[model samples]
Target: MAMAKLVVTAVLVEGRSKSEVARDYGVSRRWVITMVQRFLAEGEAGLRPRSRRPRSNSRRTAAAVEDEIVELRKRLTEQGLDAGAATIGWHLGQRHGQAPATATIWRVLTRRGFVVPQPHKRPRSSYLRFVAEQPNERWQADITHWALADGTDAEILNIVDDHSRLLVGSVARSTFRAADVVACFHQAAARHGFPAGLLTDNGAVFTGSYRGGGWVALERELVGLGIRLTHSRPYHPQTCGKVERFHQTLKKRLARQPRAATLDELQTQLDTFRAHYNTARPHRALGRGTPQQAFDTRPKAAPTAAPVTVPAHYRVRRDRLDTTGCVTLRHNSRLHHIGLGRRHAGTRVLVLVHDLHIRVLSEDGELLRELTLNPSRDYQPQPKP
Candidate 1:
């Protein structure tokens, strides 16, 4: 094109032969003449052909519609919603009655000065076995945050039965500390009786103790009840797969109701959800049967929960293991030292078992440590004893 312009200038200025200009610039004689005429009519500006764009946009979304789409995309993106402009367009067609293809929509959006957002994909963790052979066998408990009417965030600690996928009990509280959750757990246990086992992530509330266990007081309490406590592997959410999946359903259903004004109000709604979920909603795991169906079929009959009384058979020795993990036990008029799980212990427990395993229990009948009695019991040498 530049060569054509030069040839055209030559044809008009020095009247240099078109054949000579064309040969020098490698252009046709006819091309040189056309360029010369264009230059004469429109001057140097006419040397280049005009763009095909019209003065006005031919295929533009209405200003109002474009503004609406941009605002919607921005809102969704900021809220961590999925998709960019193309997805926004599809979402519009499916949800809001707009059917523009993703590409056409992109042009409209970009022309309107709306930028496409960099999309995010949440990496999926591995799967877990929340499945159970029967209902009431296992339950998982966890807490999630929601806002109150006053815009204050509150914690909702929930319990869901594993086999039937029933929402057994859930409570709303201000804090997620272990004490608060233990309070909720006790509340649930009192109503439903203790489950076989409870599974939870290693959240501070589930694992640590209110007094000093570093493990939750509830866990120790459960262990005392003979209820096993299973902690999900750290950084491994898949271990709590069922509980986490239930959370998704919960957010959708619970978000429908207005935010509660107080913990009581939240509990009321959660109670309603619990009932609805267990009794009314059909669970796929239950072959599209209601969770209540599965729970009721077995007819557990709610046996009287006998207190786990410490049998008088448990020998209580007063002279206990000091901080050095050396405990003095009197058996047949002899003081013997026993090794606790750790070398250093304060008042360590020692259970006398005939077999190799020595079961140790704390004062509260909780299993403190288990040590196997060696065929060879070491008698520490004392100076000139």
Candidate 2:
């Protein structure tokens, strides 16, 4: 527009030739003549630039559909549910015959100020993530703290399937002990079947390795059922990132509700949230399908063997032969003494055991004794003592 006005002024005011003005401004003589003609006809108004946008956009989403998207966002936000583009699209598809693409929904949201741009946030593509291939392949368990009406803190233990992100269990307790963790896991297992593996942090209730290299009740329960128990590195919460993230989402919803005065009230809220999360709310990671839907879409994985009532692995110990020529070991929470003859009394030995097959080795690496342990007997009589 500035160039056009300059050329027209040079031509009309200075009485310059069209060719001269065109040459001075590096514009075509035909363009100079046209601008001059438009200037003469319409004055300064004709010098303003016209829009280059198309007269019509047939591929654009309908205004009614955009209104529906905005309405869905407003409703979901009011309900304390996810209002993301994928979720909006999921709801839109349900209400309308066809739904716009997620990108389109995002654009509408941005234009309407329903979405904020997060330029500094990390992109999902840059993340290295792992998910189980089948439902029940792995379960992630974590505990989060919440406050009650009386200002007392309560704990909510949550269990989520790694593959489907299903909320298998959400229990509200004043405090969670090792026994409570085992009971919660059992309740979830009874409903969804046992998972192939269980993942958790090195919390005292979840594991006892940090205490004295012994198995906690929860760990013992999983191991006895042929389910692999795994713990994230100490202080590294990202190893159990999925459950940690779920805690954030769950708390966001719970924060909007009235504070519960009792454990039962909190448990009721948890049950309501769990039901909606599993069957109604759309999950962004699951391609907008509910967790229950995703879980039901795949075949569930099971433990390698049927869950048993007894332990599967025995602990290995190092001890010196007693003065009475016997080595005692704890098996299945019971102590059993093995006879090693009076000659080897006071000698150090290594007890290597797997199930009932026990091997005793001398400190010098000699195989001192090998026998099948008889758990029924407290003392194994020495042969030919």
Candidate 3:
């Protein structure tokens, strides 16, 4: 527009030739001549540059359709569900009988300020991703923390299939012990069948190798079931990246809802999320199919034959009786308080454990107490005097 005005002013007011104005402005003589004629006929309005876009676009998406797309994005986001362009396109197809391409939907979202460009982030193609060939081939388990309504912290242990992203289990508790981890694993396996292998971090509840080189309850359970167990390298979380990523998604959804007041309430929320994640929510890695769909699409991998002999854990711990005349010993990943009579307070004893069978012997080699551990009870009762 500015160039057009300059050319027209030079030709009409300064009496410059069209060829001179065209050569000076580096414009075509025909364009300069047209501008001068329009200036004489229509005045300043003629010098305004015209739009290069076509007057009409028959193939453009309707205004109403773009509005629908934006509405769908808002609705999905408010519901704590995925509102990506592909997801919006999927929903639009269901409602309108025809949907714009994912790229078109993305452009619409960007134009509406709903999608921000992330040029600094790494490209998806640059990532080296791995997926199991069959469901239950490998399962990733991890624990994440969340705050309750009262600001108390809670832990959620989640197990997911690496192949299908199927959430096998999601258990909420005030704190998860090693025994709790094994129980959750069994619960999930009962429904989804045992996996060929299990992957987890070096958390104390998952492995004892980091602490005095002993077997945690979960490791023992896996070994007994003939399932291989692998731990992420120290300081390397990418080894269990799948479950770690799931924790983020789970927490994001939980953050959108009312904070739970108790462990039970949190467990209820986790259960609801597990159902939706497994059967309803579409996974981007799974080609926008639900985890359940991908899980059922192929045959499942199962654990091989059980080990010839599941190894028994044995250890000896020495301690003095506390003021309560009790000696505490951990057996099968459970702490047991054994009452040994107040008269024996401050007496030193050697606690020997062979699997569940426990023996307490005084320093003088005199047998003080012997009993098989009852896992269901936290306190082991002494025999009557």
Candidate 4:
């Protein structure tokens, strides 16, 4: 617009020739003539910029198809199902025998104001993703908190298959205990078969290593079943990314439904969601195939009877608690201060380092304090009961 105004002014007001104005502005002579004609006929309004969009697109998605996409998005959202472009495209294909490409569906959603731009989100390519090669190769487990209609807090334990993105189990309770985790694992394994390995965070219910390197009930059960067990590094949830990501999806669906009044009600909702997620909803990571399809099509991996060995970085070092009742231990070139309480100051202790897991014992070999070191921070404070 500014260039057009400048060209018109130079020709009409400055008494410049059309050829001279076009030559000076580096625009074509025909463009200069068209701008002068527009300024003369419609005044300044004619000098405003016009859209470069084509007058008509013969290959554009049909209005009816676009309407169906919008309708599907709305219906799926209302039903608490995934309404992403890939899932929507799968639905369209299933219903009409043909569907627009995933990119086309995304463009239509954006044009209809259904998609929000998130430029600050990290790109998926930058992530170092690890996936299981086949179904039952590994399973990731995690617990997330939710609220009931009465404002009471509830914990939902989610177990997901690493290869197929299947929600093998989703159980809700007022609070989850080590026993509950073991029971849930058994139930999920009974249905989907045992996985070769289980991945989880350093939650106490999942592992007793945080206490004194003893296996918890779930860990013992996994060992008895010959399934390997692994815990994510402290303060690092990415190792169990699959199940952590599933928690977000589950919570989204739960948020769309009416808040449950009881644990049983919440469990019912979870059961329904797990069925739909495993059998109906298309998984974006699996080329839009449902989890059940992916799981069934692949060969299952069996549990290995390999013995658990100490981590490569495992070491025991002697140290005395400083006046602040904190003992510092360095692992991976980073120092971490473990709090053992003020009374234990000046006491001799052994700092055991197993990767990021830590345990402090008195000189007599009595366990004094144990925790997972949060490498992001220097001080590891005693967790609140």
In terms of TM-score, which candidate is strongest?
A: 2
Supply candidate 2's per-residue lDDT for 361. 67
Query: Which pairs of residues have clashing backbones in candidate 4?
Result: none
TM-score of model 1 relative to the true fold?
A: 0.49
As for TM-score, the candidate ahead, 2 or 4, is 2
lDDT of 4 by residue, 37-153 (tens): 999999999989889999999999999999999999999898777899988999999998989999999999999999999999989899899899999999999999999999999
Which residue pairs collide, candidate 2?
none
List candidate 1 stretches off by more than 4 Å: 1-130, 209-213, 299-385
Predicted structure 3: lDDT = 0.84
Q: Name the lDDT of candidate 1.
A: 0.65
Candidate 2, residue 316: how far the Cα is off, in Å: 7.5
Native-referenced Cα lDDT, model 4: 0.86
Compose the digit string of candidate 1's lDDT tens values, residues 65-132.
Answer: 67767876777555433335655665676667756666866877677777545557454443334476
Return model 1's CA RMSD, one decimal. 10.9
Tens-place lDDT per residue, model 3, 180-231, is 9988988998999999989999898987766865556776577557777777
Give the alpha carbon lDDT tens digit for every residue of 179-264 in model 2. 99999999999999999999999888997657855557886577557787777989989889899999998988887789899999
- Select the stronger candidate by lDDT from 2 and 3: 2
What's the distance in Å from true for residue 196, model 2? 0.6
